[model samples]
Target: MTSPATPTGSTVPTGAESADAIVVGAGHNGLVAANLLADAGWEVLVLEATESPGGAVRSAQVTAPGYLSDLYSSFYPLGYASPVLAGLDLDRYGLHWTNSPDVLAHLLPDGRAAVINRDLDTTAASLEKFAPGDGDRWRHAYADWREVSGPMLETITRPFPPVRGGVELLRRLRVGGALRLARRLVVPVRKLGDELFEGEGGPALLAGCALHTDLSPEEAGSGVYGWLLAMLGQEVGWPVPVGGAQKITDALVARLTERGGRILYGARVDRVLTARGRAMGVRTAGGGLWRARRAVLADVPAPALFLDLVGPDALPPRLVEDLAHFKWDGSTLKVDWALSAPVPWTNREVATAGTVHLGADLNGLTSYAGALARGEVPRDPFLLVGQMSVADPSHSPPGTESLWSYTHLPFRPNWRAEDLTGHVERMEEVLEAAAPGFRSLIVGRHVAGPADLENGDPSLVGGALGGGTAAAYQQLFLRPVPGLGRPDTPVDRLYLASASAHPGGGVHGAPGANAARAALARDRALTGGLYAGVIGAAHRAVYR
Candidate 1:
């Protein structure tokens, strides 16, 4: 671990360092790894290329100075449900979230809207209004979810060499708990919804919620994706940080440092340095070499870490081929709007709800997903708009509201700078369809196309927020490619501790925590004393 030394300036340089563990990036995963290792009495150093630590967990006045917008993920049910973070005690570090009563409201193309409230009974009751028996189905689904989500999260998300969750799941299958869950897993959300519910917009609306994270309800992996989102909505209600998403990162940073770790911003690590197939350390962009005496946990992308940093010669042939065949989700176009006032929704329910899902129904979601497969962008897009100032007033000055919305571009927009006006204009037209006169609400707007996101952060990979695709083919055991699902990379002592690993994305520190445990185990057994002595001397050298 190479922490910042020399109070004002750094001797164990940001781009260059020599420590026990040299972490490459300062994204949430990178930060999480640094915090965990530091707590374990290891010398840990973190390097972030961005000005801020959070990769997508940023809240800035992107549109106008006063209107604070959550840059990437806005509503976070996953953040609240994260076991890694739940263990961190971050409230003392300055992270607090406020949840509105109604978690989401989907304004249908027709004037009607389906509002999902925090209370399951109320949400079920609301569904009953849509259809007499749909309410019971909703409750039944939640009960089923309560059963499997634990097992699913355990097997899919637990730390490395994960056997317990897998063993338990296999045991359940042997007994018969797997039949219904297996059926749910195989059937697409479209099929699942058809069998379960009777409603005009309620089923489709719930599917829309599932589609929020860029999943297609028609796809195979999408059944679990859809059910989990719906279940979590009823179980935990979507939450946004009280101030902004940055508060979450701030809280994490505080706890990490308080645990005797060090953080450095504007530090860029170029490559993972290895000696005889074992991970040693890293080389920074500025030509400084930081060698790790024990382990190196990398928070960079898989391709960047494997191909660019460690080099192809160091990896197995099958792994290289898999990396080549590894798929990335299509590019995205995100827009942050600084509204002069609240957006006027046609269905008034969304005017107060935390999130608004606007787009076509189940069929439309499949069409959009299919369109991306054909490399065509959707004219009528699926948009999720989050009203920050609606639930939290401090996001903007008194009375005014802050709204940020996003829709994927499916095919990367290959247009010039002058062409952005057309893209933003098209996005506004899509918004105006659900929220009448949405153009009038726009006081200031900031546009970030696929290139902009990649420019801002390269790991975003065409601005696909979940690292790569969250589809069935690229999820769980197959994430970032098969066989190396847990955070361990091809290089010894170097772990891929990012969203690209299993149980992917959404501000959860599972990947980081998983990687840290792996590193800690490795560090404690064979190289613990050697790394401690070297890194401790490195820290004390500058301190004296």
Candidate 2:
């Protein structure tokens, strides 16, 4: 098996290489696509611009030695629930998952909290503490979710239009039922919470989950994301890799290599070489060319893929114009700490939770979101905090905590060092309010601002974590631009296999799996021509 490339300053071979398919960017999505294509017996070559794989799904001793912290994403409820990831059977490749005692907890100014435990009754009881009968409401909501979750998840993760999954969903929840569900999904999270629960506990839980995306509680369709994630956590506890986030990437790389796939690191693709309107291969910044016999799957952001790599001149005029209006999610600021001891939360239950949402109640959350929308740095920022050592003991030394928290910021062209430091202090203030003397426990700390995040991974453009905005206007069939919501781009033999495509972001590999499936379907000898003809015509109509 081939070893992974060095983490920095790796040499680029100066020669033209050829493979059955060239997958650009070695992010989890790109890796997932490569692994699937390799399983189909096609020789795959992955070109990563960075020194290593995993993009944001990486880990390092950022705060202090022996304190391993996930550089970007930490929790993975989606990863656990994702059929695509589960189908890969990563367990055989040394990937193990572990969860904290509780899935998540949302802390309030009053020191009260709403917690979700692996046990449904425990979660319901926690909500019931807020108000009488709220527990039953939560149970009912979960039951409803359970009835639709199977088909709902399938319809979500499958290729857009989700024909088979849609049919099953329709059969289960008739025409009127489907219409009602759709209406509910489009409602604002605040409204959905009010409709579903009487107490602050349930609503607070939903609102906290919704903030996980860029969407605020009042935004339309935000409730769907809130409900989806919350229910997924209930079904499958928010688990983390036993060691670090890197294990997930290592597992994908191991599986790909086992199937005879190759990955070239530090290979920054400068251009996607197209011949007669069809993608042929790519040329790296080092003046090396790699040709693909069949297809090229790009796991980069939409703007980078279309404007920078492919060039606007090569794309349809309409597509280029549409891209100019692409909306990025809010930028982010993250802080990591190697603590002398665990955060002494006012609510002891929060310490048992892997993820904690602090610095906001419903009204506080609304104000914080509003501040971000108006391009103002929030004084009371909502913090999504992770206690890494609690989730996976291997992340830090005994009795110590590897902790992190990130909050969204408005997009800015640049951030001075002082500006980042100031924001980091603000974030710490939020944490300190929830856990008094939180600052005293820090042994070391590292801060990553918006620019730092983008520099580390181009896909996280402007530090927008979900690839692009998950707003209603830019989702489903309209994601990355209006089209069939499939992976097929205007260019033939090229697919958008990143979170920029339909279904947006998360640790789930749906976008990559969808792209791989599209490539395979169009390469089949029997119906390949027909599939290409239909998809190509659709692209023409959309771009015309």
Candidate 3:
């Protein structure tokens, strides 16, 4: 197979093509995998179903021609802190991060705001307003987080079983301290907050962070996520690319192309071509057969990779049955607005934040989440709002704002077109309650529900962000259905490189990095065959 240059100057396969690795999906994870493989001198090819890259990490002028709105994810604390992304040195490829004066603001029902600032003293002071000594408690919690943050991040980002990282964590915290921390992490966010905070401010901040996932404040293990994100914000302010989220994608693509990796857009992979229980290549919907000599990495959801692409016949019966129970996170409904002016918040502190959590107090969040779990939409939805222009001024014209807010919805809601419109109106009302005259400032508005999001990026799988549920039952080794908790799948030479893998969700790029490392490890001259033999045996034992 010969490579030919496309009109856009990217190399594409002229006929049947073979590469050392074929990555299905041009999402950030897939692109990360391609970049790593290309850096190792492999002929890497990425096939994307859409016309562009960056799946959910994309931005566009959806509201208006001049205004830039993040089509999906906006703020990126994980991207800034991720060792995997840092290793890529994306800034060298024109990625610049920008942050607002504050990291986040959670506006209470009474118009009091709990804001998180980069400065410890300022954040503590903000919390102190609610309860006298709550500030000191926050300080103590933050200090504890700092002690274990290094090893904790390493453990979470690295492949599961986290041997080296786990050992390092034990060394850092000691046995008793580690067990205590584990106990805290296992409880519900509500309980964790109640135990740690005397006032509503601290608990509100933590609960708001927990809502980022599908888990409600009452769910066990929600505390860990909430605490992790809150700590990350204090450590590294939630930031956006200077221009837009697309800049992050552009940086990855630039680095990959520089390394001679090729990405073919509009190539929807229809099947994982396997023979003798080994994945050898992929067939696209357009009838293009691309072969992979070393590996095929899928930056797609577990169900799509296993059931749709690989087919049930090729999968073990147990594996197939487990997939039937694979749970997706809540569907999302997002609204983007081109505002004529910045939001006129009741509390000035809310204006300083790049991100805001609105329409919820601590208990409100619980009720909203409960509604979703019961397959019903909350009348007063809890919103995760982004002020893109506040984070990056280039997102909109001077004095104006590129704003977006998203709320969780039931996985399958029986709603008509009018019902969705009514939800949008309700969202606007909630915004208006927090930021008076907010609706008046909107110059344009665009709404994206589950179907629309799925159309834009099939990997989103019904607008369910984070790839899959972040529930305790589906996390860690149980992710994408148990087994080795690594990238290796039941099919040989295939890897799951999406958020469906371990260390689920957030834009950390760990899953992609892990997959790349696995592929490279199994392709090494001396240890390659040995590594493959062991991994293959483990899969056979588990899947059998």
Of models 1 and 3, which has the larger TM-score? Answer: 3
Q: Estimated TM-score per prediction?
A: 0.90, 0.96, 0.96
Model 2, 179-235: lDDT tens per residue? 988987899999999999998989999999999888888999999989998998898
Span of ten consecutive residues with least summed lDDT in model 3: 1-10
Supply the TM-score for candidate 1.
0.90
Model 2 TM-score is 0.96
Worst 10 residues of 2 by lDDT: 1-10
- What is the C-alpha lDDT profile of model 3 across 316-421, one tens digit per residue? 8888888878899988899999999999998999998999998989989989998999998799999899988888899999999999999998885234678789
Worst 10 residues of 1 by lDDT: 1-10
Instruction: Give the higher-lDDT candidate: 1 or 2.
Output: 2
What is the C-alpha lDDT profile of model 1 across 1-544, one tens digit per residue?
A: 1222212111233454567787878888888888888888888878777777888787788888888888777787877887778888888888898887688877767667777887888888877877888888888878877766666666655864468876777676565776767677767777777877888556775677667656677777666666777778888888888999888888878877887677777767766766655787776677666768767887777777777777766666667777886766667778888877778777787788888887776677778777767776676777778888886888898877788778776645254665556767777887787777778877888888878887677678777777677777777667788764667665567888888887777687888888888788667766765754553443234222
